[model samples]
Target: MATLLAGMGVVAVTNAEAAAGCKVVYSVPSQWQGGFTGNVAVTNLGDPVSGWRLTWAFPSGQTVTQAWNATVTTSGSQVTATNASYNANIATNGTVSFGFNGSWTGSNTAPTSFALNGVTCTGGTATTTTTTTTTPPPTDDAMAATAAMQPGWNLGNSLDATGSDETSWGNPRVTAALLDNIRAQGFNSIRIPVTWGQHQGPAPGYTIDPAYMARVKEVVDWALADGFYVMVNIHHDSWQWIANMPADRAGVLARYNAAWTQIATTFRDSSPKLVLESVNEPQFSNSSGAAQNAELLHELNTSFHGIVRRSGGANATRLLVLPTLHTSADQARIDELTTTLTALKDPRIIATVHFYGYWPFSVNVAGGTRFDAVAQKDLTDSFDRVHDSLVAKGIPVIIGEYGLLGFDRHTGTIQQGEKLKFFEFLGHYARAKKITTMLWDNGQHFGRTSFQWSDPELFAQIKSSWTTRSGTASSDQVFSARSSAITDKSLTLNLNGTSFLGLRHGTTDLVRGTDYTVTGDQLTITASAITRLSGSRAYGTNATLSARFSQGVPWRINLITHDTPVLQNATGTTSAFAIPTAFRGDQLATMEAKYADGSNAGPHNWTSYKEFDRAFAPNYTTNVTTLTSDFFAEVADGARVTLTFHYWSGAKVTYHVTRTGTSVTGTTS
Candidate 1:
């Protein structure tokens, strides 16, 4: 009979040396290669742990070449090992639980003695009081939970160079603790990615340096401790993935399996608190070779499912999200996708897509035309298309990227209130449609963890932005509130706590008092002409885009290509425009950004810079001179755009542009 030998202060039971490192338990009747395992329990009745090292010596040659949550290092049949980051930290009182798919070659007998961390717990001690194994997966209702945490946290910014720098641990935050500030300021998730090889040793290939992984684990652990869902993935590992495509068609699956064997094993046993994205925006734009690469990607993802299911720890059934060929929701509907879709033996597989409807506008990758009246509609149209398709397939969708830039020299500028309104509305739309959303946030610039999106002005406005459906019960109102976008149009767009309404050249089309239509993440304002500013002689041209979005994605404005750079002359700004030694004939200006996940989005070459470079003709605009910090010009005849750039934090340079279409030389500082 089992009895409790209770003691005061702490239980000093006999042979207490075998403290459980993992504390999860499970009872599953499954057969290993040699025998059957009906129940298992793993516990971490210890201290701070990055992971664990467990070794089960075997008399026969039954080796563990493949495993998850735990890594294996063998020498001459004497096996030794440990757990990956996810399982390593057997918190003082916390525990992990999981089962493995193993095989047996001969007779077996349960060991009578067990020792953990060099302390031995003799047989016949206390077995009934130990914790079990297994991490419970997230349920579909997860969307409702995060939505309820903090309502107006839908919009986000990508913290490029001026925003953040990479840390040794693959975290983009200038430091690792920023996530707490982000959470306190009201954000819910962080997407920290590592360009694996970029910061890791071993140049540009396999073998993820231990130091890099160690650093990454530290940051990820920090995020989880703060209670935010963390997304860690393999980012621009350069050609680590592209160069290592499966040579033999079948081997593709094998390699994919092996890669995950390492990844899952690394973090599999942690709490069921993080999301593991299979890959980032996989791309190969060069040629027909793109198709071959796409096929390989699908094969890799297919293999990812099995590997994830077999993590062999608490994360065995953890949430696993899969991206499309390039994570494009449109292409994700490819016919062959059905193969992987049907093959989804595990229920945790969530589909992912990147929502950058207004490309140059969202990322400003290339200097394109600034905001247009219909741009917002076009942006949401794409979200609707993807939303409808994913919903029809009965699966949750995730928008990986979306943002608006404040530094476009030609046509890039949106009201602060407008952006916040965009965020609130997007979340409403997504919630109305019952969709889960995660904002891809950069460290700062537009206010990430370091800066507050809901500051003095943005805070009251964000709360006021959401409209409650009157005359309904609390629960129903919340439900209806989620599906509908805020309709108030009189919403003033503020920036850095400054009013933007009176600053524009003309009266904006956005009404002073009217709510826009909201369905899912799509929003449309009923207005004649939303007036926005562009091209201040003191700064560059400013294009005010109407904002729109899909639930689960960042809300953003839209912009088209500009015919000419807004830079008019050179002599007006800091000095006549002269390319820095860093300039390489019209190359796009790019930056590095750190997201909420403690990861960085980088090396982006936006549009306006290149357009300003190749098209500026001095004589047509102002004294045709200087530009830096802000654009300048003489508005006599037709406007001529000129461009000048200044180095700021990193590769990101601030632009000063000036142009005069005719009689219009207002400066934008």
Candidate 2:
């Protein structure tokens, strides 16, 4: 990247550039081929120019590489740049000025001449600003989101405010000032989840409670002032808004269209920084209730892209996020639809993916075990799965929500150490893979809020770095690490004062697979990745092992031999379950450890236990790391069937499927 420091007054900021009519039109910004900023202008000078185009001849060195908003087609010294489809409707007889921002390794100088519609324009020279702040570039989505920040504390409870006692988040609730903390922490975007229904007036005339919305506006206004990419979406208003969406014969479609129209138009002229996400997690289908819900969400999807595009400005070119049924990680993979977003013509259809492959932990069981080591590889080979698919047909993907949720339910203390480890790992991997991710912190836990951070013991542990918090892998460093047990099968390796997080060899014996036996005293067994994701037990100071099974329960001290390994020292909770509830609907079987507590909570702590169980059913199978189709063997061709819906609502229902190297079409009963 090139940084050119110009003396004062070298850069011009005229009154025309700041005028109300000066709309700051779509002079799109592109990726930084180099780091620098400049000034220039093109005037109409009274003669009306139909459909304006900018052509500047670089002085032998300023060859255009890549540009956005405007596409540049270069042939030698003369570079021709034109407004991409969305920005083609520029007016004539009006002076338009658009500059570029990029990097240059060679000498930085102003382009010698500029031609507007083949006619030479004046004021050809400008200043180039140099910058030294070179932070790691964010994934594409991150850049777009950070670019959309409408600075403000998320109106978490207030937006959905049944007006009960305000359930404030982050007690000095996230305000304008909180933005500094967000930026400092390397976060690039903020998504504001809103509920317009509760704030609507007594009448159904689309007249929302201006005061309630104003509170939200205050936050967006702050974010805009701070210059961050902000996204505001309809969150959790489905019951009263999306779900209860009139399930009629014909009027339903009209209501849906008018609703989004009002929403899109209301925020149309706001600011380029504000991005409108179509909807939140709208549940479409389960085993039951599939038709109406399915039809509504489908129509919503078909309308969102077009609706936001019609909003204009950045909204026209602005990135729109599309969520799927249940916002399922696998559901977002649209394998069955021919046109994932073909109905819309906008170039900025950013397919939205929510992280929390294990949502049971984030919400239902907040403060679960740290999955840093696991959430890491889950990104590798799968990034391009959805984006590439859409891009081929013309679309991109963005990871809008992801966070290491380690706020313990029992203690309410944020599991900072392990959770941050998860974030740091995902952040690095996400950025490297070119996929952006937003942290899902409502400021409730994770050593951020007052109540949680109040504990001195937890605070100190959370403040310290779990793995190196350096945030970047230095050159010559062995980054992009892919670690597996020297063997992927079951085994216990000791840490042996190795400065690593593992068992000590002198302190633990190893198992190779999942067959264990107890012959009076000695324990014997085998092991596998299934066993690896499960819990284990400590046999002695120098030995650790898995628990033996006695009627499907761990018996403690499982010694796995090539032959007959056995388990010893069995202990059981006094109260027993009529039937023990284990991990269900788990496709990958990421992990499992027998956890039971005195409070009668299931498996409070696995501490040292045995046996990870394979889930019997999976809603959908995906590569946990890259989250795409078939991280493993593919589902047989005739084995799958999809159910599509027909609704009066203006939405289209699509199911993502990876049909191998070919295509397959069929229907469900």
Candidate 3:
């Protein structure tokens, strides 16, 4: 059974009893005048346990105010801390620790005893450790390793590009200088995705081309030499062959194992900084449901684990990353990966998932143009789930790729202000959740040839988010009507923990009271300032102002002066129909087209508001709105459809169009 030796201050439990024997270390790592931070480490010394709960009674009157890595609650002098979802299992000799901030009065004393799983802990010790210090985790500590690789970047559309070679995707060849530039840009790690199926031989061998392998090594070596934690993975091959695991299980598994065998052998002596990901966004085709998919992925992961660990050299202890089905952050996917990780029983394993934000908002479709509450909730919920499911349990998680899906078309698909807010908030929240996020570049963000960011402002916000929060506002644009008297415009500022200093225009500071004023979180620009800034009533952006803050990047505010945009009648063939238009400095937001009976008449018929750039696109330089063939193809022939063009300036214009077979006519009636 179990024996408790009260005089010896120890408890002896037998494995036959299935009771837990544990040791607790409680220390006050830091203390202020009336507050302190407490850290407790629970080490299970006997009988592996799952879902552990540790309880203790405080000797002094200390109240826990906040906690991390555990769910902690206090009742008077008694306190209890339970394992989080992801970290519920503590194998024999495994240690799980958590910390908290508490308020103390006059005196602070560590608890003399602690219990684990209702069994009194033996060898419990309490100390007021004056020095705030932490021992660096061992080399194979995946949690510490992944945490050190924070704020990573993806080398996208290059090696992973589905083509003949690395440069086939239009991005230039990888260069050492590029690695230098990335390091200079504040990225701590780089994920190099290599698509192997196209470069591999057929059948049993499935041998990857030696030259392609060498090239991949060159890039990985460069990153490692630059002191960057590098991750190399099989990218698009997931769809090329791995996804067909259900239909051709043996063949897929053979090829998959062969690929990893060669890869691990090649990088077997590489630096410990190099990490191997089993597969990128692992998936299954023709699977019954989540159960089969999970089983299929588990097989691949187990095989990968075996191949890499047996390859010897650094591969023996190398950090390995595994992805859930589709690398989605859904709870089921996370739990699936958790089971795989636990089955592998490897401490150097990390779970990876990709996030492109909420679908509708990510693509700027269905009028999800703004990063509103729904979108924000989606992001927070996903992160919270991942944090609780993986990170909190001592298992690290890496957001392999994160960005707006619409970024593929172009950044302009989403408004500048909304995009900034999304990135700013994403960076801040990811850091808060203790999860590392890697931006999915795909050559859209950083320019390869120029070695510069395509959008400096967006990059600035992203870079700043790596460290601290940046202030943002409700909207980045202050629209002023050119035909009417200028009125004061106000924007709600999101201080994000920093105080706004003031506003400036091209280096000249605006007078706080005369030109602008800040009351609480509302920043207002005076009417006189708007009138002056809108010099000559320009049709587009008349001026730009920078909102300075105590820290982080400055938020840009554009003063846009515009009147109601005008559209002229035009006629053209079905191949091309460009409505003559004068934007008058206003920007198109969305378009709506409907027939006489109010039925949607565009490509996306479910909603009257059509997808920007897909159905209808505005060409400010050409001064025309071109209705794409996609839109006309779906329109009823010989039926007149009324189109409503909405602009960012809050102005809407109505026009009518009739399609008669090959020809089309447009009118403002």
Candidate 4:
């Protein structure tokens, strides 16, 4: 589908329309002696495009050392870059972007001209086009407060660990010089996570030890004195038996109320720069699932909110953050917190979630050497969901604790290039969404005494993302393929796409506009295309229609009906297919597909039924690749078209080869 133009350096499909006014904004986020980070955004001002290729010539002797969101190739000073798979399809008036870290020898000058698909862009020079002003969110106090708290650094482990003594956690004692250095590096906020349970009294009215409380207050004073927004929270108390055990709920609630009451009362007189967080990663289990757990967490959050509200003085107006269950990134978990907190109608309240998303990269666990396309997609979709579900609704979100901790723990083993990629991508993505991001440092990478980071390259990338707002890289376009039955004349999809989710019989790519009138993700099939398919018997009741996710990660969900013999009577078939190895038994689908015969089956399928079927379960630690199922179809034959449906989670290459019978053929948008 990708071809180089005959007489031009452009690469695109020959039959595709050559779009005009393809503007590209180039920006040098940061530049040192011999290296600089560059961000480029390609905006399609004309018709939509299924794919794009950008070509430019670097004026100076700059050579790209690292690139992301697009594949880059440089021959001498000329650069030929193609969009990554996830960003290939760009909608009309929509934009896709990429970034790189490059090095120069003597002179470093920005490129003068740029071309996309052979057409000159409006803003191809070094100077970038100023887009519309990003109006701050409607002036809620909480939103305003969170808006200013961008790109933060957490004082982790020192205070939040088990011991009350900061040095007991292996981190040096807090210092004023450390705070000054942090502010110099572009961090406007400091999140000091403190474990109160370990330092508090036992039983009904658990009181925080005065000296221990003073220690926490001392750290808060240091940050506040330096004019940094300081967020102090009850951290890691859930590890104790009283906090997370169901049998200890009554005693736990009493301790929780007492601890927050004392902490809030102490900070009540402090400046508005001080934010109070209720807890850190509240833990508990329920047999009823996430919804049940959410219900229980709701009670806990309510207690935290009420206790903080009762505390007088500056605490009344100060921003208060309530965490999602376990600080989970799952939409359901977040929705629970958002819905519960929104009903309180507290304008000063904000939501918090941890972003150890894909622990292999974020945690020190084993994972891939590179932050590849799949990781990019996962990051995009996960945070974008937070924006759509919470931020847009007047609730600002804070990724309170996030970073590639795995890099710090496995320094020599993990690639420094991958660490840089993770920080840069995460920073840019957070900037685009205007979400507050904080790096979780536990005295591992960043040294408190020396004011130095073990990985200077990683720190530089984070600083660049924080400082460069005009031309920071944007997360790749992410679209989840949703299913709607094909109507008489039109097939309405979710959003717009650069290309049509193609419809084919077997191997032939259906002609656009002739077979279907396409606009974005929606495709309206004309009578001609329907007539042709009918004549060819390509799409009928007995035919199988499947569409692959063309952007971001690849996923295809098959909803198998319980009535099918595979679930009801057959023994050799499976219900779950292509489950990611990092999957900690998280249920991908809530509603199990019924058998083709209209009978219901048990919900648990893949994890229990098909383990032996997979030889190597793909996980982040081993290969950056996920172990995908070699077999696709869970149901053998006679699958009722109504029963089987496909859904996908954000995973890297979840499906490499699809299973289909003679009558099965579909499209990939």
Poorest 10 consecutive residues of model 3 by lDDT?
1-10
Listed per candidate, the RMSD to the true structure in angstroms reads 20.8, 23.1, 17.6, 15.5
Best-matching candidate per lDDT: 3
lDDT of 2 by residue, 1-669 (tens): 333222222122235322111111222121223333333344444234435567766553655532433566777666776643323333433444434443345654556455555554442233333221233323244334433331122334434444421344323444554543343222335677776665554333655555665677777766555445567887766555566554442443444465567667767767655667777777532323545555566677777667767667555665567766555445333542224455554455566666653433332222233343333445443444544554344454456665433332222222223333344444444444445555454544333332232333332222222212222111100101012221222222211112211111112323322333333333233333224423242211112232311111111222211111111111111121011111111111222222122111113232221111111111222211121122112223323322121111111232222222334332111
Where is model 3 more than 4 Å wrong at Cα? 1-138
Candidate with the larger lDDT of 1 and 3: 3
For model 2, what is the C-alpha lDDT against the true structure? 0.40
Alpha carbon deviation, residue 614, candidate 3 (Å) = 2.0
Instruction: Estimate the overall C-alpha local distance difference test score of candidate 1.
Output: 0.41
Q: What's the TM for model 2?
A: 0.45
TM for every model, in the order presented, reads 0.48, 0.45, 0.78, 0.51
Ranking, lDDT, top scorer first = 3, 4, 1, 2
Give lDDT tens digits, candidate 1, residues 33-83: 243232334444544444455443444554443333355566765555555
Reference-based TM-score, model 3? 0.78
Every candidate's lDDT: 0.41, 0.40, 0.85, 0.60
